[model samples]
Target: MASGFCEDCSRLLDEFCVYLRKVCREFEQKIRDVFRELSQCTCFRIAPESSFLRRRRRRRTQELLSLHLLCDDETQLLNQESLHALSRLASSEDTDLQTTAAMFYLHVSHHLKSSLPDAFMEPVMALLLSTDLDVQKTISLSLVNLLAKNNVCKELVIEMGMLVPILELFQSGDAAAQCHSCACVTLLASSESKSEAIMVDGIMPLLALAKSYEPQVQQNATWALLHLTQSDWSTRILCEVGAIPVLVLLLQSSDSQVQFYSCTALCNIAAVREHHPKLLSMGGHFLLKSLLTLVSSSVQKNSTQACRCLQTLSRNVLIQEQLMELDCLVPLKALLKNSSPVRRESAITLLSALSAHPPNNDVLVSEGLLEEIGQLLHHQTSVIITHSCKIITDLCGSSMGQQAVMDSLCVSGLLGALLSPSVSDETSLHVTSCLYHLVTWDPLKSNLSVTITSEQVSRLVRLSGLIQNPQLSYNSAAIISTLAMTEEMAQLLRPHYITMLEYLLVFLKKKDVKLQQLGILTVFNLKKDGGFSSLLAGSELEAQLWKVHAQTEETRRLLQMITPLSPSPVDP
Candidate 1:
């Protein structure tokens, strides 16, 4: 059966080119027949209104049946010619016939959702150079749908050969051709090697077309540039082509789409860390405000791309300063309220960048950004909670931001997250670092025990005792010392004195003397309270352990300070 089938296919292959031309002519004839029928129906309705309703549904059915029959005929032709025959006919030397064949197949592919051969990609790509405006329009319009719908086609075209031929479409004078060809190269450039091929040679054309008089061509070209500007080499080549200024100017396009494309493209280039100097030299920082516009966009992808762009841009110290100069801190913080996870994630990441910069904290603290970030502490997504913890921890780098975070986040946010039963080890570390910084900076100035419950206090003391997580344990151990500065603060930790002391002893027993100093100090603060100290007042084991670890000057000073009833430890 296979041999017979191959033999018949070989016979059909000999005449498939003629068969394709016939199919094209028949398809065009069917279209003209429809126009003739529509003309007749219009005259019939004008001359006699009685026949309008009678003929309308019948004509519509016949038109659909005719199109369906053409599709059935094409499917039969595909079966007869076999897939291999498509390659021969698609590469035919007769350009006009090839164009018509492309038209017929494009129409058939549209009408029938599947079973269209991908072997025709080369013909459509080659037709890109046709000087005929109508041919260019036909191929450009058809190419976008074919490429968009088929991943198999994308893979096939990626292997076909050099993308240098596609460059002509970028410079093609016709607007529709220019618009769709821009779209074509955009889709084609999604392939990594092909992207390099296009970026290396076609970057100039893509950039020039990005400034087109036509909005669609500009949008399409900008979208193409976004795909091509991904790799380090492409980004460098794109910078060499002066895309930064065009992108900065295109950010203000009246068309929102063009603006978004330019934002994504420019951001992709800016994501390369080494390219930062080039971007700034070309005045690319001017794109930040427009990028902010996209961050606030109602479209999720636009918002996501914009937030990510700013996230990378903010990494540069100069751009971080530029972001503050543009007054971007408040608007950036507004994205925390967004419902989309992706957009919020990117926004949170950007805030993490801003929050770490000391100068950004001036604006952030003034804008009350801490309060907004503090609210997401118990968010259902653990990653957001983790990143939020990081943001607050970074914000704690400065005294003013630290105070603002403590004022807004201490009771309402970080403590609650730290006290949660399911909080991960990583999140616990950052959250405790925030508390550690808060108390270390202005322990006595701010009252942490105001609204905090005994349970939350117990959780912190217990976290300090954790043996498995040393960093969290040590930071929590350090936090317990300053948190005990006030009588009321010491009183809150009074209930968990046993757990608190266990961790502090764990700190003292270790070889690291700084931790020993911190441990003894924390014990001194907790031991000074009568109620807290009285729990271990009669316990000689505590004193003996202290004596054993007091070999260092710091530990002895701590011991002496607490001498008359053991009242204090050495403080930093």
Candidate 2:
């Protein structure tokens, strides 16, 4: 009956006084129903609320009505009734009713959340500032729920100039208030324009809380720092403000989650290419050692995160060398055999970084790592095989790693993988990329087939046409271009080249200026062989040839589109 009453109360809010006397009598039955239902709802079980949930649903009805009144064009007519009801309810000493009253007032005073709708700003701020801790928490949480609407909270916080008070809550408010305030600040800083302002105005306050004994404050503050550091210069500011040492300290916290977020924040900031050394100088290696050690004993979730931090730290050139000196490669290599393909891929990616320089390559090859990577290609998983192919690609692209790869049969297997129609685009890209490196480095042209089979030429030609997609086009063209440059290779490509030119001539007549330019460049390189001249010699070629044929310079004559009946290049 009381649940029905609250529903009716919203529809008949003007009669709230008549219903007020019966609220207790009717609310009892409804309250029981609510708790009975609440026993099943996740929120009530997760953070069970008996008295709070019972009252909230009713109060929410009133608050929604007040909010509607605030936007009503009929506000003048309802103003007197609404204010009298709110004023009476606000003066009530009962905590739950007062909490409800606070929510109701803040709802109507929507100016608290938005700087743009300056409609009720001063009044709402005064009401909120005057509320006691319990009421303040209720109102803040209620206001914050609106934040879930997307950039709503962020825009308002910026307009209200409330970062300071919100940050003050981080130091002094209840956990609920602090969490919401941190969340609000997070929403605000998410805006690129607002981030710098928060950093300048809010960082000091956030830093104080980041060091607080409270884990919640520390977690949110670390997140805030992470968000701020996404900007170009936020790193120097964060480091100067002692964020590095604090993060390192947080990494040592007894709380695993705190350590996780702090490590993540540190990794994000450290990943910036130049700021890397500073992160390392400030005990980054010690943190990485700690993270790597966790890989052996920690839960799989935590171990994965620690491994990721290790990978992020490994991206630094100087830090990677230091890791090698510490002989960390054994543990990282050991992870390649982990049951998780993700773990193995991460290990491969980290190991690939060893090829970044000659010294690192020396360290890696001395371990006979190429053979292990080649073994991964034989593993059943495509992901593993793809990553292994990538590692082989990176290694062979360098001068030092070629001989081990060629001897491993890596090239043939990878080529077969590329030709498989079922291979994903990503795998194909990696395989072709590896092929490019392997073929270009093959000193004897041993990798190049003496007779490029018709099937291979047709596939290359089809793949070459995909260049029109722009991304794949240039890369596909370069691959075809490379394959065509070999001596016997040119003869095998002759049929495909003829087909490509036929399409190229048609594309040239199109009005797309960029496409025309790309088409011309494509044929320009092919015509250098003078094989294109014989193909274009017939009267068939004369019909579509350009009118400005003879005007082209002597050196470019073969590439210049022909004028019909112009003297064909009969001799050199």
Candidate 3:
């Protein structure tokens, strides 16, 4: 079969590989011309056979002989002896030896990175500049492999001014040459060092290549921009260069990776707050749809990136409405149900931010967001629990949202988190804040204990817990103070009376006006129970009552309620 002929070509290449490697050893001057001409490479050509490019659906492949000859096992890397010999041959007026040596280096060039020759890029540039189209195509592809993850070589190539020629080849060459050229540029673009070269070389060429008819070139160019836009400054620069429109179009590409790279690049561009308005004006609605579609991507990083991009966009208040109109909460809830920790956390934060808009709240609650959060509040990771609690806190800010949430299972999950020993300080802050929102709601005030148990109240009033973290202390004081507004909820703290006295005394001496008022109100509530009145009466603030000048009318009114109720102090 004609197809089997390619497999047999490896058998024919053994003689060529052996003869070529042996020539480097003996310094045989007589047969050098014969071997050089035998390696003349007439079997295939990488340059287009014609000027037409759009019909070239696939990247052209090299001949079987070269692929067989240049394989990993067939090519021996150069030592100083052969390196000098190849150097002399490489510099010859004959283009065949330059092409021959460059072909062998498809396997050999990787060795240059081992310890790195002093002028390693010199021959790379030399071979790349050969008038022979064969040499340019071979070395360009080889340069792709050589420069990969090797910043030192990348810098050497850039400092040698190799990019302009590579960019030229990328811009003007045939399919094979452009593929290699774009690849080399893609590898070189991975670090911060290329900014200066890119400044001079400019990204317009890459933007042009992103729309290349060839998928590989298009895919690579788009991917390179993903790396280029790693920094906010570069992203801003890319947007200023009109990258947003190009990225927007690539989102419609048939290639999945192209779509992915374009999505992340836009994520970077969208991260700049100033660029938000531009992204909106350009095609913000279409952009949101593209991102929302990717949010359900099967690839973990794909969805992670999409979620991240959405989170950044959600920060803009206008985009929040767009998101709600798009029913964005549906996939976000799915992500919360099952996804990576990173994706889940991002989804949580985005949902929390969206909950800030009053209208988005009802949409979220109806979309099973409350049910998802109910499960997340009991997740294994405290960070998940923390983020979930934040959504509850944000949603609980509104009367309609508060009523809807209290009717769901989210409240019990929150109460369970409050009693869980593993909860972090941050989780405690948000979770306690949610509890405050619920207990203080007027409709819920008639039956506050049904929503928050007395045991949870006692935990909030614990002296060590109250003074432990400032935010927790504030929320705890707020929750306990709100409860102290009614005697039924105040008696929830009766067993922990001494703990409440110590907690109240701690806050009563603080400077925060809200904390001062909450502390004074709780002190007034505790005094209503006569048995413990003496212990709180001999308190430091009571002793300094007249000396304490109230900051607000509310604080002064609450302070006057507890002024000198009794002279005697009770036993601890």
Q: Name the 10 consecutive residues with the lowest summed lDDT in model 3.
A: 55-64
Per residue, candidate 1 scores C-alpha lDDT tens digits across 7-109 of 6787887689789999999999999998778767855564434678569546545534443455566555344333333344345565554455456556754
Model 2 lDDT per residue over 54-107, tens place: 796677577547645655553342355555555545555555556656666445
Ranking of all candidate structures by their lDDT, best first: 3, 1, 2
Find the candidate with the highest lDDT and give its number.
3
Model 2: how far residue 543 lies from native, Å: 16
Could you tell me the lDDT of residue 476 within candidate 3?
78
What's the CA RMSD for each of the models?
14.8, 12.9, 13.2
Report the CA-based lDDT of candidate 2 relative to the real structure: 0.61
**Higher TM-score: candidate 1 or 2?**
1
Off by over 4 Å in 3: 1-124, 130-161, 164-219, 231-242, 252-256, 277-284, 339-343, 358-368, 380-390, 445-448, 463-468, 484-495, 510-516, 528-531, 534-572
RMSD of 3: 13.2
Q: Higher TM-score: candidate 2 or 3?
A: 3
Clashing pairs in 3: none
**CA lDDT, candidate 3, residue 233:** 48
